[model samples]
Target chain A: MNSSLVFLIVFGVVILAVILIYNGIISRANAAQRAWANVITQERQKNKIIPHLQTITDQYQQFESGVQEKIAALRSALGGLSSEKMDTAKLAEVESATRNLVQGMHIAVENYPELKANELFGKLMREIAEQQENIGAAIRIFNQNVEAFNNGIEMFPHSLVNSLLNKKSTLHTFNDSEAEAGFDYKPNF
Target chain B: MDKASPSSENKQLATFLQSLRTQIYHAKTREDLRHVLHTVRSFGRPLCYNNTSYWLGFSMGILLGLLAILYAYWYPSSVSAPWLIGAGGLTSVIFAVLIYMRRSKVSDLSDALFKQDVYLDNNWQSVPYHGKKLAAQLSRQFSEFKRGNHSREIEWLVKGTYQGTDHQFDYHAYHFHYVDQRQVTSTIRDSKGNVRVTTRTVYDHFHRYGLYLPFRFARNIAITNSWFGGFFSSSYKPASVEFNRKFKVSASDELSAAKFLKPAVVVEIEDLGKALSGLNLEFNAASELCISFEQNICQWQRQHGLDEPDAFLQEIEGDQKLATLQKTLERIHTLMRHSDNNF
Candidate 1:
């Protein structure tokens, strides 16, 4: 084989390899960005539940105390929300408080047996449950993104780029107990 | 005419005087005085019954008579048989009388307890009654004794004292002492402190069980130290028995993956594409080493005319630096698990 022909073939192959690597990197970076956005979306959905919860709970003044206290605490923690540095521990506390408040409300409804059968309260509870599920889904997506980002920075070839860019992967996680238990709120009279 | 008029007037006057004297005499008898006095007393004075003294005297008399009979029976020969028998009959009569008296007294007290309108006095405390039945009845009627709430509060007060005979959880003892707003202090101590006290509210206590019996059982268990004995006795088994039992091992391929791979590798390569993107020349050095090692394996396979060259290539490619890191992590995990199991 001629030297010029060999050089041409080798050069083409290298170009194709570089393009493939670049495309893979770009697609991964985009996915990571999308995942971060999802985390924010979930957090917003969680926040939205607070007001509706408050409104529904307004009818039940006695039951509102615990729920209100938890909501206030959660709001304070989430005030300066940043997806880049979400505190896993704080999130866990918020999640737990939310669950306990839900339980408290459920118990309170037992006093007024008719309240459990109230259309508004029932709808509100269902909505809150759905919102919680959505938040969980969002958190999972965010964690998935974080895992991808961390992998890219730590994997071969991409690790070199990650180091050069000085980019660190954020940890996105939910409370293990909460995730396992799945929003337990049992009512007893 | 004058003589005849004077005789009739004189005869009429005598008859009138005789009738007035007879009526006056008839009104002053013993029965009439007695009736008048009774009426006066009934209207003027309150009916007085010394309940405490009455009961005490009656009970003491019965006790003394019983003692006398017992003494006579012990020294039968010292006393005449007829005399002893007579005394015994007399004692029995007294005893029967005392019992009747006691029952009537109790009935009177019960009526009083029921009829008396208890007002929340300035002290905000209930007046202590002499009779137990009276006190209990008064407490029920006057105290704000709602079934659920009051029972719950009382349960909280009595939780560790009552243990049910069934279940291991019942065999725990608890002690609780608290002073209420009335300054009435109560202390419940379970000498056998085997009970596990829980923070479950009174509502929960009842809701968990259908009736008060189970609740009482749970409470007694909480209060008693004997609960542990009961708990263990109900399900007594030797350590050897537990050890002898074979654990069924269910084969799970997914679970096996968790056992083989290091946690770090699974965690790091969870997003393989992103990890590859993050890697640059420096990070790729590890991958290059892996690739070179794989290439050598491939070359060796080619020279040897190995039928499964691709399989060997896959094995080499899959066993990256991440896998090595995972293996190290796995070793640490295994060591931790072993320590935990030993503990």
Candidate 2:
């Protein structure tokens, strides 16, 4: 082929490659954003479950003190507490306390058949379960995005741009507690 | 001759006829004749109590009307102007007195709803309650009721309970005053666990300006969280230094550390500060710096009349006071530089 014709062909190939890479990056970024949004939505939904659970427990006021203390602790931890300060030990403690509270409620329900049958109680349980699932899924998606983003930052050429934008590697992988807990188990009491 | 033979019987019959005629005449005059006519018209329906209240009310109403008319005429408008003025004044005075009495009654209802009498150390002090719930159910119900669904509010309050032995949880009762659709009057508990009273007057402060106050507030809260987290958790510690050196270091590196951290550390600090401040101000303005920050924001918003977006933006942009923020940041940067040089 003539020199001019060869140059045109190579330039066209390079443009196509760039377009493909751009699309891939855009998709990953969008997936990450969607994942974070899901996590936030799930968190809000989970927060909403507290009131309903409280109502069911109200009839058993004998358990209020213990439940109240647990609730107050959870509120302090989740409401505005920084994740940075939340070491593995503290996070585990919080998670365990929450699990225990749920277990306590399950035990309480076993004694009160009427509570278990209540429409509000049933609905609340379902919602809480769903929220937990959603949050887990969101976390997974977020981790995937974080991995991709971090990889992009570390990779040749892209790393330079990432540095200029001040983007750093984010900790999006599952924590040890999350890995140990596996999927959240539904309490049958 | 026949009449003479039964004179006693004829005389008794004549007397009975006269008595019957007199009874009919008296019935017609008394309007009892209408009752007799209606008896045939209805055939056999008995008089009912349905109209009893109506009839009694009608009579009483007529009497009142007559009395009112009589009073008005008794002191006729044609009478001297002085007399008319005196009567008018007296009537107004009476009306005012009645209104004052009614107002007190309404205030009592408001007080019961919004005031809490918390007993601590053998003394009862009045505190404001904003219907906050430790339980999730009650809080949702409170939020719903505040949104105007009163039925849910009552159901939640009646059914909601905290976990514990059912020792009468009277001390935990909260009160609320709906100052407006957005604002609330409440007493919050401070860091020292003392009650701090506050009136939160939520306006459309951001809606008009196309700003999201809640989001902004949340961002600030997040920043504070990260700051505290990093500060407390850091394994790295600097050697003991003079007060000046410590202050200088804090002003520079400590502040800049947040800026460089991944995921934007400053936002976390700002968010944490705003949230804590909001809570602190609501609970106790006397002890916490958050309350002072809130007060400053409130004053600035008020002075700038933030309801008008254009005016507010202009005020903030043109404000000389905002320069103080930049100056402070610069000073902190300078201190950090000095500390870095020393180290």
Candidate 3:
């Protein structure tokens, strides 16, 4: 009878430990998913500003035809993006394309200073800047959550529990060229 | 109401300061001293209280009087009434004399000299009659003015209009204070081995140097070194990673915040933040720009005696104070010009 009681206590402790670890992993996974949703939301918001840029830049097409064509190609490329299939690689591609679009706008503005005089153009410029800021913020938040999620499944007792019950994979963090080069710090001894 | 120009007002300040110095140095008779005190009081906020030693003396007297009474009551068989009365009476007389001497010293010319020193050091003046209206307008418009749980005060207000190269804007500068009370609970064991629990309310005072620019912004934006600025709704991270790490930017409209914080403006703000800790910048939709930072910015460290003509002259004649004022003005000008162009 005493042995049966000891067996029951150990069984209860193991079940509680597994439950706690399972809940922790699930919470981290949910947080990572929510953060990715935010990134997709910000990217879609950024896409809405492209039409405004096109309208203003179209009037100055004589000065920079190459910029206009690149912006047009970017809009179509973004149109086919599926939120469900969104990953860090696809997000990085969108980010680089957006940067190229902004660079083109800068070039167009430099070629035609008169474009800055238009009130619509000024407003559109501010909107684009805002979108760029939001996208950057969203990506950083997403990467932080992914790091947390990956850490949860890879650390000590959590790793043991994940291996036994929840076979989850580590998530990838989004990396832009600037972030990649900026964060890579190697010291010479 | 019409106001004097900054240059003209500064001239008046210089003239009045010189005359006060001369009067303080030459005063000999009590009447002459009274005249100096009157002039000092006219500048504002008079000191009417006695010194700390006087209060300490009175407190000691009260403690001794209470001890004498306690001794007599507890040891009725040992002490007599006459002895107790004599001790109490002697303590009262000593307390009265301390109060009288301290009051006389304070009422003479010491407070006047202290006030003069403060006036010169801070360049402070009495708030105008319309200052209430201005403070009220600020509380209504800016979120910073509306903060503080216990109390809020705006003092030493100075107003001037700066004529920039392309545009001109009015600025109101003041020292703002906010007080908050926090309750602290403490438990102690006394000499008799009895436990005591005491709860007291302690006050936390926050002092800020505030600059108000009565200009309109297209959108509301707040940037602060802390995440709890509580001025706006949404948080924004600009493209500058350094800025994101040091400061948190929030705005009601992200587009306007982006336009306002151009690269040049962000660099300027970062420099300012590095110079000053606890810096906060707010551009409200009410067409006002409020810049505030923790602690007093203007500091002068020279003191003069009433009879020392050289030190008095040196204090009055030095341009270090004016240079400090101009440096502050230049900083404000640079920030405003950047925001104006970008926004």
Q: Which prediction has the highest lDDT against the true structure?
A: 3
Better of 1 and 2 by TM-score: 1
Local lDDT at B306 for model 1 = 12
How high is the TM-score of chain A in each model? Answer: 0.70, 0.63, 0.86
Best by TM-score: 3
- If both were scored by TM-score, which would come out higher, candidate 2 or candidate 3? 3
DockQ ranking of the models: 3, 1, 2
Residue A30 Cα positional deviation in candidate 2, in Å, after optimal superposition: 3.6
Q: Candidate 2: lDDT of B175?
A: 23
Q: What TM-score do all the candidates reach, one by one?
A: 0.31, 0.28, 0.47
Clashing pairs in 3: B215-B287, B216-B287
User: Which candidate do you rate higher for DockQ, 1 or 3?
Assistant: 3
Error of 3 at B262 (Å): 15
Name the fnat for model 1: 0.00
Q: Tens-digit lDDT track for model 2 on A1-189?
A: 899999999999867765555554555555555445544444445467678768766866755655677666666645542333313344444455556666666765776667677777777665554445445544544565657755755776555544545454443554547545676764462
Sliding window of 10 residues with minimal summed lDDT for model 3 chain B: B43-52
Residues A1-189, candidate 1: write the lDDT tens digits: 999999999999977765665555665556655555544555555676677677766877776765677777767765645666456665566566667667766776876677788777776676566446545555555566556656756787766655555455534445466565666764351
Q: Looking at candidate 3, what is the lDDT of residue A14?
A: 90
As a whole number from 0 to 100, the lDDT of residue B201 in candidate 1 is 25
